[model samples]
Target: MSAQLFVVATPIGHLDDMTFRAVEVLKSVAVIAAEDTRQSIQLLRHFNIITPLTACHDHNENMVIDQLIGRLKNGENIALVSDAGTPLISDPGFKLVRAAQEHGIRVTPVPGACAAIAALSSVGLPSDRFSFEGFLPSKSSQRLLQLEKLKDETQTLIFYEAPHRILASVKDMAQVFGADRPVGFAREITKTFETIKKMTLAELVSLIERDHNQQKGEIVLVIGGAAKEVDLDQLKLDQLLTRLLEDLSVKAASQLAADLSGVKKKIAYQRALELTAEKEQDKLDRDLN
Candidate 1:
C-alpha cells in the first residue's frame, strides 16, 4: 500500500487561521515538502510540530518530485506546504501530487486559507464569476501589454502582487482598464496591519501616492468586470471618433471604437461615415447660410 500525499493549507498571515486538521496532518506526515524550509520552520515551531521538512521550491521542484514519489511508493506519508496558503497555488508541488496519483497513491487536500479567495470574499466585488491572474509580469511594458489583453474581459480579475510593485501595477491597470474602474486592494491579509480598501483605479493610485506606507505588504488586487453596456450620444460618439481618428484611419478608428466601447463595428463604421458627412455638410452649410 502506497502512502498518501496531503496537500495542506497554512495561514496566509494570521496564525489562528491555521486549521486543526492541517496541524494534525503536518505532525503525522512522515516528511514534509515545503516551498521555503526557513519560513515553514517558524510555523512548525509555533505549533510544536517536529516533522522533518525538505525544500521543494521552484528551483528544486523538478528534481525533488522524483524523490518525493519514491518515498510515497515506500508507504511514507508526506505533507506538502507552501510558505503560506495552500500548496500548488502559485507554489511548488503539482508534479509530486500528479506522480503520486499515477502510482495509485491517495492525494488529499486539507483546505484552509487562500489569499485570492480571502481578498475576493471580503472585497465586495463580483464573486459570481472571477478569474485569478496570479501575478503580473515584472517588466512594465509586458505588464501593460498583459493588462491590455484583459481589458475587455467580462469576469472580475484577481491579481497577486508584491509590495514593491503594487503601485506601478495599479497605475498600469488604470491606464489599460480605465481610471474609473472599481478595484479592491487587500494587503497583509489576516495580519494586524491587514487592510482591504475598495476604490476606483484613479483613487487607488492617488491613495498609494499619498501614503507611502500603503505600498508595503502582500497585495491582492480585484478589478471589477467590464461594463456590460456603454451609452454614447451623437456628441459623445463624434468626440470619440475624432480622438480615435487622430491616431487611426477612418476604418481603423471605427474598429478601435467598436472594440473599446463594445459596440458593433458595422454600426460604428456607419456612424463614423455619418459624422464625417455631417462635418462636411456643416462646413458647406456655414459657407452658404
Candidate 2:
C-alpha cells in the first residue's frame, strides 16, 4: 500500500516455490520492474497477477532508473522481480535499489527461493562460512585469473556457471585446485531432470564428459575449500633452516621454520641440528684441505 520498493523473489524453476507473500506483493504493486517482462508475464499469468509489467534489465536499468525512482517519489509503490530467483544476485537492479535508498525510499525484501542457497543447502559442503561468488567469468583468461586469486581461499566457494561453460570452468577449477578437491555439482535445481552429484573435481569432470545430457540447464557449483596440508618438502625445510640459522640459534630457527612450513616443531628442531652439524663438518673438512 505504501510507496515503497518491494524486492520480490520468484521461483528459480519450480513454480510451487513462489511464496504467497511474494505473489501478494506483485498483485498490490502499481508496477513490476522485471528483468524480462515476457518471461515474467508468463509467471504472473500463472499466479493471476495482472500488475503492469516494465522491463528493467541489465541493458536499460541505468537509463530508466531515475524514471522508476521518480514514480516511487510520486507515491507509487513498485515491486522489483527478476526472471527467476532473487533479483540483484548475479542479476540486475543494484543501481535502482541504490538510487531508491539514496532518495529516502524504503526497499523491502520478499524473500523466497534462491538457486544459490537451494543448491548450497543439499550440496553437503560447509555452509557456515561460504562465499557466493555468483557467476564465473566467461572469458578463459579472466576466469583463470579469478580462479588463481581464489586458489588459497579456505572457505567453501559457490559459483553459478552456464551449461556451455560448466565443463570448462570445472576443468579450470580442477587445474587450479587440483583433481582431489571436492565438488558438488547441482544442475537444473528445483526442476525435472535435476541432478546433484557430490564427488571430487576429477570425478565430476569425468562424469560430465561422458554424459552429455548433464550439460543442459542452470548449474550451481559448490566446491570445498583446500584442505590444510602439512606435507612440506624436506628441501624447502632445509632452505628455511639454512637462512634462519644465519641470524638465530637452532631452536629459534627451527621454531620459525615449523611455523612457516607447517611442519612439526620437534621434526624441524632435529633437522636444524643435522644442518648445523653438517655445516660444522664441511667447515672442518675445508680447513683440513
Candidate 3:
C-alpha cells in the first residue's frame, strides 16, 4: 500500500478534546508537519507521542512543499496539524494538501475540534445554512466595507475574530447590520471560561464595552442574517396601484404605492405605468366599439 497524508485536528483549548484516532495517527505517522513546532511539542509531550515534527505554516509551507511531498512519495506516512483547531480552517496546510492530491497521494482527515463548528453547534443560531466568513479586516474602514457587502445576506453569518478586535468588529456589525440584529457570541469555547450567549448586536457591543473580559478569548460570532422582507401580494399591489392611478399621476401614484406597500419606488412606478397604459387601451377599445 502507498503512503498516505493524514490531516489531524488537535485540541483548540482543552487537551482532552484530542480524539483517539488523532493520537493513534500522530503516533503511527513517520513524521508530523505542524504549523508551529513549539506549540505542537507541548501537545505531543502531553500525549507522549514522540513523532518527529516539522514546520508547515503559511510563511514556509510553499518553500517546504517539495520536501514534504518527496517524503510522502518515499512511502512515509505523515500527519499535518495546527497549533489549535483543524488545519486549513483559517489555519495553514491547504497548499500541502493540494500538492499531495495533485501527486495522487491519499489525504485523510482525522477530524475532531474546529473552533467554527464547535462554536456553531452551541451558539443557538440556525445551523441549517450558514456562511463562515473567516476573519473580517483588521482596519475599521476595511472591516466596515466588508460588513456593508454582507448587510443583506439572509443566511446566518459566522465569523472568527481576534480578542483585540472583537469590540470594534461588533460595533461595526451593529452599524451595518443594525443594532437590533441578533447574534450569538461564543468565547473560549470548550475551555474553562466558555461563554455562549444569544443577544442583540447592541447588547453585544455593550457587554464587550462594559466588561473587558468578554473582549478576551478565541471569539466566534454567529450573527443572525437580515430579516427576509415579505413582499406584498402582486394582485393586491396591482389593485392598489390602479386605485391610486385613478386620482394621482404615475409619479405620485408610484410614490404613494411604494410608501404604502414597502416596495421600491422604481418598481412601483413601472407597475403604475403598465396599469395606466392598460386603462387607456380599454378606453380606446370601448370608443371603437
User: Model 2: per-residue lDDT, tens digit, 1-289?
Assistant: 2589999999999999999999999999999999999999999999999999999999999998989999999899999999899999999989999999999999999999898998889989898888999888999899999999998888999999999998899999999999999989999888998999899999999998999987889999999987766645987899899999999999999999999999999999999999999999999999999
Q: Pick the candidate with the highest lDDT.
A: 3
Superposed by TM-score, candidate 3 places the C-alpha of residue 265 at a distance from the truth, in angstroms, of: 31
Task: Order the candidate numbers by TM-score, best to worst.
Answer: 3, 2, 1
**Cα-based lDDT for every prediction:** 0.91, 0.93, 0.94
Q: Global CA lDDT of candidate 1, please?
A: 0.91
Report the C-alpha displacement of residue 281, candidate 3, in angstroms: 48
**lDDT of each residue in 185-218, candidate 3, tens digit only:** 9999989999999999999999999999998989
Extract clashing residue pairs from model 2: none
Who is ahead in TM-score, 1 or 3?
3
* C-alpha positional error of residue 49 in candidate 2 after TM-score superposition, expressed in Å: 0.7
Clashes of 2: 0
Residue 120 in model 2: lDDT: 84
Residues forming the 10-long window of minimal summed lDDT in candidate 3: 227-236
- Model 3's lDDT to the true fold? 0.94
Model 3 scores a TM of 0.80
